[model samples]
Target: MRPFPLLLVLLASASLSAADVTPPKGETPPPATDLLGNPTDVPTVSKEEAAVLVVQGKEAMIESNDNPRRSVDAAVAFSKALKYYETTGDTDTICDLEANIFWCKKRMNLDDVKSFVAQKSGDKTVVAALAKVDKVANKEVTADKADEYFSRAEKFASKNPENFEQISVRYFEVAERFVGTEVGIKAQKLSLVAQQNQMKAIKEAQDAQRETLFSKPTKLNGKIQQTAVPSTDTQKSSASSIRTLYKSDFAKRKPNQKQNLLNKLMDQARTTKDDPVMLHALLTAATDLAMECQDFYAVISASDLMAMNFSGVDATAQKKTAFGKSKNPTVLAIIKLLDNPEDGDANTIVGKYFCYEAQKWDLGIPLLMHGTDADMKSLGDMEQLKPDGVAQQIELGDKWYDIGKKGRKGQPTLEGPMGRALYWYQLAEPKITGISKDRIAKRMDEIDSLLPMTNLNYESLTAKQWDRLKGGMAVISAAKDRNDIGLRLTAGKKYRIVPHPTDTWQPTTYYSSGNSRSVNWKGESLTNTPNTRQFIYFTGGDFKEGAMVMQIENGKWMKPGLVEGDGRLWLGPFSDYAWGAGGKGEIRIKILPADDE
Candidate 1:
């Protein structure tokens, strides 16, 4: 807001001096292990020498006139001299020679030293020098020269002690350093950006993974069992990175990281082979990383399966079909594992499921069709959408939401935004025959409105939830979408998973053999008979009969029906015993203002 000329003058001075910066000692410090990783090492100067050095440097800067370049040179010299003095502490370098350097011949300048002192390290002698330089930059010095001088001045000021913006300056300096460099300047810049982004991604992913894997804790039998890896995020990131880098011309370039992602992936596939429906996330994660560094470019040379590397290893010729073919060994192994003793197309059904879920839908759909002798429409409505699509992606999100809510006890655990969304999704599903179409439509609508805002995923679901909802629900394995989570509860027994926010808890004080009704709708044991019966459902609103929120009228799991009268909500199937399910112990869902009763 200052006038243009004054602004320009301030700008010129700003280039050289932002604020007070303590000058470096004239002598360099002793060659300590360059602890800060900088190029140079210097020793500390004697107090007397450091003081004198500041005075002389002040004098030099003051007399630099309009020349920012000269000012910068003087500052650099001062810095170097400080380095040298600290290194040797020679009395001459430290003190006497400093006064003579600026005062030699016709340049015996005094007034300038005072200004320099006031502007720089605040030593009196340099105040005169600063005033002189400021005057020069304001009047005699051209704009360009002022900029140059200011830049130098800023550089000097940057070296001042107690300047915490070192990292910010370092970035600009690095950018400037590469301004006219020969090789890979642009590439380096791009790579720098990518590296930053990659770091952010690595951090977030590792954080989320750790959070999911270790989100909850409970005293099980008065003993604690750890279900998740303990702060091994760095290791996982390293593994993930290795695979990502490998996916990009890995054979041509050696992987900088050391973890063997491919081997880990194969091992995961082997162990998880039996669970054809389970999404083996570790395997997929390893695959994601390996793909980043692996050779995707297919060569035209005559080749066996190993001749063309899509994955890390040289594949066997038995796996070969033609050139540039990416035959997934994991998928194949999974397919082999799924081939069943029970029936003809059951194995292929599993294969189709995994293939499609893996996003190799092209491969999976075909396989499924071959076995079924019909199009995929019969299995389920085959609607594939890009990760962000409304119909496909949103619906997918909603489905995951439901799995977290309605799943059985002691299996998958999920909470938080992910849990809330999953709860919403669970509440949304059409209960084929149990609930009417209108209710399903209304709940689905509610879920649709929620998922976009929540941004939850499947993996965030507990391992148990993942198994029952995704694994048990789907005939084949679901695709492991990085964008969407595929949760599974691994060690619920090890950790304490309490009630989630969306849970509907029905306190059982009584039980009956038949509820005095013809049909026992919800299959619950009728053992105890407590007069006080309470069915608690975590719906945001109360449930009325025939409402989608809860079938107060006879619905799935509720045999005789629930009746509300006189502010008393009667929840039934009138069972004496009720089973409870807690998600994997690793996940915890603390509602907003968490636990604020």
Candidate 2:
């Protein structure tokens, strides 16, 4: 089940950073965009990801338990499956057997993991993994019992670092100490030992997984993927330039629908002053649904637009990735909005929405940007102010400007949520009012001019076309042009929910619960299915990370625009064979929430 913001309980075996992971130099494109274009940048898998691997008694992986051919699906199968032995137990390691299988599958397959596991049992790596899984599988250790065991184990382990078997024995002894020596011994020693033995019974599981499960790289099929990174920071940046990594064209997307949706959400919020906690949670969830952002509209609109829908938003923009441009469709959408930025509605919800934001964000921007001529003029030019107000203004102005700068920069490396909140806050008022007519016109022209070079559509597609049906039915949704067959998918769909094969060689995933073993049509079930109805699914996308984009920031380029006028891409799709990318079997995972995450 989905939890509140940043409160996810389990660990996601996040794919590595997409930065270093780019399209293979000489690969061809498949049905989807190249690795770089797919927005499915793998979540950063921290060392914390290892925590989910050691679930209760059983090993977790991406596959279901019922698959006789579990090997094929083992890599994505739960992470715990690889912890089938004592060697890895209690080590807090990433070396789950399933993890090894996943890596091998990506490179070689389960065969590699099996062979790897076959190494001498005494191998330090193997032993640590066994130990880690043992602890996760245990569900009954009480607090009192746990504490008792903790002290004993700590004493024993600290004294004997070299003696693992002794440490292992002590670990269990302490654990069992909680339920009284007898019960603890039975659970820790007998039950755990038995569980460990059971895991090993399937000795060939790793090998089989390696053979059937293979990870395809995310290569751009036949497109000229001239990969480059933002070597250094430049002075100026904009929304479009910020999120340039995915190679999208947001302008062609339909507009009014966005406004309509945002309008609808604001209505609901005012009508029902719901409980703030639940409301906040609901709001976050609702906002997430609207993540299918093309530009800025999706960003701010999401907050006010969905109070009416229980359906949960599916395609709005993400605020986390909001600031400058790339992951944030809002900024781009917002800039598009600011084009004719004067006069917001005094009565209508939309008017008030922007008004509210402008009031908030503007409070900071002009204060910082305009500067104080003196307090007396009061920002109209201003007059002298008391020293205290001056100090306060400076502090306040700094606060707002910092946020404003972040919004412009797109991605600020600075820490703290206040900075983030303020970034959004500064834009609330002002509503780009100070953006003179010349700047607005110039901004529009500059944004639109790049559209042709990208050779992509900016219009939103109708929902009729982008039906995201479940099952093997992938969104066979077509792009605006052939060259962009999979390149740019407008925010809205134009087609009905058609059944396209979701399981492509490109990154594909299965949505199921209950160990994945229970509900998977493929006949596998995940073990710990959250009780709440949740979308446990995955997708085929490029698993690359840390890639940079050609963007400008604060009048300079945060990264070079080498790819900005990357003249060659305009010719069309990766399949063109015009550039280095386009190859087959080069796709990774792109997971979409049954709703939106």
Give all candidates' CA lDDT scores: 0.30, 0.28
Clashes of 1: 99
RMSD of 2: 26.6
- The segments of candidate 1 whose C-alpha lies over 4 angstroms from its true place after superposition are 1-142, 145-313, 316-597
Q: For candidate 1, what is the TM-score?
A: 0.19
Model 1: per-residue Cα lDDT over 1-597, one tens digit each: 000000001121223321222234673222223432212322234444444444545443333432332343244334434444545656444332232222221122233333444344443223222322222222332333333433442443356423212212222233333344432243234334434544455456444322210121211222222122223564456455545744633343334231234444444544542332121234334444444433111110112112122223232232232222444553333334333322225434433433322323333433443344343323322322112112333355454445435543332222222333433333333122244445544554443443332222332333233223311111100111011112222321111111122222222222221122111112221121221111111111232211112122233332121122222112222222222222111112221210101
Error of 1 at 353 (Å): 4.8
- What lDDT is obtained when candidate 1 is compared to the true structure? 0.30
**Which 10-residue span in candidate 2 carries the lowest summed lDDT?**
1-10
Clashes of each: 99, 177
